[model samples]
Target: MSWGVATLGAPTFLTIGLLLARDARSDHPFFWPSLLGIVALSNAVAILRVNQSHRRAAFARRSVLALCYLRAGMAAGCAMFVVLGWSTGALQEMVATLAEMLDASAPAIAIVMGTWSLALALALAFGLASFAHAGALHAWIAFRRGAPGPRPGA
Candidate 1:
């Protein structure tokens, strides 16, 4: 795999690993791990398929494909999170608490903070997904393309 990919994926992988570790210590450990595994494996397979098919494709084409993958992953992740959170009642609880806190503040301030929180969450999700997709693309490309030649005079 490409070093670039490894570097870019480090944080995401680390975060996943930490979450997996934490889940392992919990009473219901298998659930989150299974879900995380499915998401990670599916994304990897999709990236590999795309990379294999577009090995010799133009940069612009590959980039567009990557963007598609990123958006798809983000949407899937968000949907899964929402569904799980809702089913567990965690989402409702969190929303109720947030509303309570917001209600105690000034109307304009609460509105601005709520909007800002949403924007920040969305931005963070997008950034993480972008990094993961880029890393996957670079990794698959490096794997399929084989080793590169040594630099001149090295």
Candidate 2:
């Protein structure tokens, strides 16, 4: 597995940890932010690999699959983080931030974050699954293209 795929494990583990350590009024945020940062950096590396023209032919199909899988993992991890964040008043913080930016109150902020998180989580799930499917399809195409020619008749 590429380093990009390998690094996704960190975010997944952090999200699991956050879920386990949920507290409504905790002062310190879980490692979720660092998890996000790590995933983002991994994706940046993958993007740079894809953008390198010299390496394009060297990794055409593999690169595409890696990128798709990376995106799927990233979306799934972030969605899971949001779900875990909601448990730790990060949801509240998110709402407060939005409300401050828009000049509103807590309840209004709750409604906004609640709805947005729900919609965004569902959308992320859908996108992640779709990207995974694309990666599978691409893999199948590559496999078929690389098959050995038919054997000669007896």
Candidate 3:
């Protein structure tokens, strides 16, 4: 099974979601719904991957599945926080901080704000995934390195 295919879809959706959601004009027909859908789908895939494998393959599968869940969950949650802020008027605070720059030059401000938001979203995704998989890193390596063998006493 190609783990990369399962892994790539979630982040791609999330990155696009966050970028689209950040726009002030974000009711752009596709942003918010896409974010929600991608998040739900990513979690579904993670759950499926974790449960689908046999016990003997569980150790190898667990790391990837766990990381996928962690990444999707954290990134989606953070992006949701930003959306919640938009809905609840907390985004006013963010806008206030950017007001001067935005007034002076809208494009630069947009670039800066968008980059900051997306960078943090990506960081949260990567950091949570790394932490979740850290303990299993060596186990995965050893599992792959060990020679094939019959069941003990079989």
**Between candidates 2 and 3, the lDDT winner:** 2
The full ranking of all candidates by lDDT, starting with the best, is 1, 2, 3
TM-score of model 1 vs. true structure: 0.49
> How do the residues 15-49 of candidate 2 rate in per-residue lDDT, one tens digit apiece?
54466458433354564454455354534443443
Q: Note the clash tally of each candidate.
A: 0, 0, 0
The residue-by-residue lDDT of candidate 3 on 1-154, one tens digit each, is 2233333344445565566658535534544454445445444444444444323354445455455455545555455545654565444455556554444555786767864665455435543442233223323432332235799899
TM-score of each: 0.49, 0.38, 0.33
Residue 33 local lDDT, model 1:
50
Runs with alpha carbons beyond 4 Å of true place in candidate 2 = 4-26, 29-60, 103-154
**How does residue 125 of candidate 3 score in lDDT?**
59
- Look at candidate 3 and tell me the lDDT of residue 109: 69
**RMSD (Å) of each candidate, 1 decimal:** 7.7, 10.7, 11.1
lDDT of each: 0.52, 0.48, 0.47
Superior candidate under TM-score, 1 versus 2 = 1
What ranges in model 1 sit over 4 Å off? 1-13, 27-31, 41-60, 94-101, 105-154
Q: How well does candidate 3 match the true structure in TM-score terms?
A: 0.33
Q: Write the per-residue lDDT of candidate 1 for residues 1-154, one digit (tens) a residue.
A: 4433433354555566687777667434544454454355545554555555555553354456656555555555555555655566554555555556565557877766785565446434634643455545653464333335599999
